[model samples]
Target: MAATVFAAQGASVAAVSTTVPAVKEHLGLSATATTVLIVAVALSAGAGSFAGSAAIRRSGPVAAMRGAVLTSAIALLLIGWAPEQATVTAGYLLFGLALGGIDVSANTRATAVEHHYGRSIFASFYAAWSAGGVTAALLTAGTARLGWPPAATLTAQAALVLLLALTLRAHPLPAAPPDPATATGTPPIDLGRGLWIRLAPFGVVLLVAYVVDSTVSAWSTVYLHQTLAAALSAAPLAYAAYQVGTVTGRSCADHLVRRAGPAAVIRIATLLTAAALAGMAAAPGWPYAVLAAGCVGLGVSALAPLCLASAGRLRPGAAEAVLARLNVFNYLGVITGGAASGILGSAGHFRLAYAVPSALVLVLLLTARSFAPAQGVGGGVARTSPDW
Candidate 1:
């Protein structure tokens, strides 16, 4: 149920995210201005992580989800109908706040549900998010093709979430306490304050994944429209392609993880993505560009979740704190990477912008080993060859 609501929220925002190119034209925004807008959204979203977590703790997940969804609806309406630059910018921030809350609350609930079931079902939750994103991208394409006003389109998307919310159960699910058993059989490595050092690789990997993700989500449409001369209706297919890969990759990630340890799977996947991104940057036309987008989606699918899984169990009782800090890393990557790509695109270097993150995939390749099972909180587990 929670995952379903999260999916609706994901779809609503994805519509805005993938259609930025169209939005820019709608408001006559400069590339620099669009960059600023995206950066603001990413920054505020990071803050929402902490704020949303607090909300969940106090009011419960259902309340937090409801509040966040409605908040996003209001923000979306403002964005769709705002008369000027400042109004739309304000709307982006408000949307960011709501997105942050939704992200945390949904993930927290998913984890709890997974724990209750005593198995690994968390991947399905993320697959749903990607599915929503894909749906939104497709919807945006269809809506644009039909010559719908961006304002009406966005308002309808917002309404979808609000209406979906009405059907949800009134109360939140029971909070599943954090699993006491260590995630990795290995004993915990208490770095004390130095735990940051141990967590650096996880952070680095997540940063790169998000950087690439932001680049794609925020710029794919722009690239297709401006660089390839794609029709506005077809441009969002680039983002849709990316999300399709994301859904398929995540849905099947556990199989790969189980077949080949995470290290091998992630490293190989990064390599494929890096190559795919390079291909995307040099795409000759929209069809090729969309194909490249799919490659990228599959390539980056497992990175953020794998890293976060490792980050969460780094410490015995500090899981929340550690996870919170990692969330900050996630947004930081988006802000830095998304801003850089947006600015570069603004400057007529969209190809270079796409190419850069492709290069960063190597950095993730180097850090792939970081996804190894975490140190035990008390005693180390048996160090099996494939355990990592």
Candidate 2:
């Protein structure tokens, strides 16, 4: 059920990416304006993470998760139905808030489930998210073929995704007891000592990883068309290849992490990311570019899931509070990645944009060891059985 919530979120995100060109055309938005809108959405999402922490403390994780999904549904409707840029931008902010809330709430819930089940399953949950994205991309293509308006298509997808989220409310876990930090008159998350250094690296890694994603998603089509001279009809292949690679890598990520641990998984994945980016930056043609995108997708796939799983297990406060803090990095990544790519793309530096993120990943390599475990899941939160 927690995974389903995340899957629904992924589908909505994929749907939006699928329709970006259409949305831009419809609203008469420049590339810069659209990217700025994304930045705004990301900022709101960061703020929403804090708000979600408070919501979790008051209403329990279950309610907060449900609310976040429902909120996203409404935001989608607004974005789909809106006639002007301002209205659509406002809708994105609302959607961002929902995304932030869901990120903290669902992951916190999933961390508990993973620990209870023993071994590793968090990466599998993220695999479901990638699969959901692929499914949505397929849906978007079908809708486009049927001559459905982007607005109608997005609205319909939102409704279906929301219904799916609604049905999964309590299957895997019941409502969490309200986090006591709200009532204890204390800071929600413990930012003490080693926890800060441990968490600080995640922010940098997540930001760099997300910028890579943003650069590709926002500009792959343009890069293929303008730089590689691919026909417009075939430009989307780069994005599609990336999604497929992500699904492929993530499908086995949990097993790999379980066998090797998070630090090793992340280190190997980071190297692959750097190698892929170098290939992408120097690709001679469309086919090479497309293939490199798959590598990027596959290598970058492990970071988010691993960082999140490790963060949730790091204890000093409730997982909800800890996750809420970690989730802000996602928005920072989204905002900066999208905004940077948008700027570079506007200046006609499409080929160079992917390189920036690649170079940033090398810097991230320095922090790879931060993902190492200092301790197991904090005591008293939940019990685990190896038999599972």
Candidate 3:
């Protein structure tokens, strides 16, 4: 709920920020400035993730999450009242830091919960996140339509986040015992144990998935506007469709994992994603394009949580550290995805953006073996018995 609050608030800010010509004008910026803002946001988000991971290592997940939520609320309020572009950017940087901490802490907590429950729960947790994004987008859109001031909308979101934080007082799950073999009186993770070697292949899959996800989130609307000549009001529906697919896919991810296992599920999902990307690239009309994009969303939906689950299985005690390392690559993919889309769109080759991810999906299929079940069910800490 706290994450939802932050997402909603951020969305409100985005809606207002894009429409407020005065905000950009005050900074003497152009359309290109928006691109820079996005890059800055991604970079800040990555830094936040890095810092959040470190904090999680020091303080437990619950404390880290609380701090994250409080800090984010303050940052949102600052952004709401900022008097200059520099202040606004600083606000965003703080927001990014908060979001990063919240993200890692929450995922760590969720993973620990799943391990305790002995089932797959990451999908459901992520579904809540997707729902939060959808809710935020809708709320922002509605506020814009209602002619609410940007500051007012953002302030409303901040208030809700503050309220939500008050209810999250539970302690985090217990940390896993340190492996004497891997421990050196420091963190549990063994970088020398070919950890990245185990993580990299799956990380590549996550990179491709994030690239496609980011591209659609950041560019689908613009693509529809320029390529299909869609109405300004209708362009956002393309993104909406993608989110809907993501929500749907996440809703069903556990079932798919249980029925087919992770390796098979990932293989099928990669193929599905590739096909969806192709359809998106080849679509001749807006309807077809939206359909393809939604398919892409559906196909890639479970990749992140599943990949994180796999990473958890690889090194049970060091899941947080493993995820932190993978997150670096994941954020890099987001940055490159957005930049690649912008560059391609500028060159009148926007279709190539989709094509690039399709190729990556193929590579994912070829490297599927690296993520084969390593004695675990749903990538939880425990190993799965062959009879079961």
Highest-lDDT candidate: 1
lDDT at 351, model 3: 84
Per-residue lDDT of candidate 3, residues 1-388 (tens digit): 3234334333433333333332444455454654555566668778878787777778766667778878877877777677877887787778767766776666666656555545665676666666655554455445546666556656766675676677675632344333311122354455556887878887898888878876777777667767777654455566766767777888898777767777887888899999999888888888888898779878888888788777765655655677777887677777788778767865677788788878777778876766655234433354332100
Worst 10 residues of 2 by lDDT: 175-184
- For model 2, residues 103-211, the per-residue Cα lDDT tens digits are 8877777777665554466777777777777776667666766777769878877976777676764543333223322122355554566766768888777878888
The local lDDT score (0 to 100) that residue 107 gets in candidate 1 is: 60
Q: lDDT (CA) for every model shown?
A: 0.76, 0.74, 0.66
lDDT, candidate 1, 197-283, per-residue tens: 878998898888888998999888998899899999999998999989989998987667656767887898799889999999899
Work out the TM-score per prediction.
0.88, 0.87, 0.82
How many pairs of residues collide in model 1?
8
Give the clash total for candidate 2: 0
Whole-model lDDT, model 2: 0.74
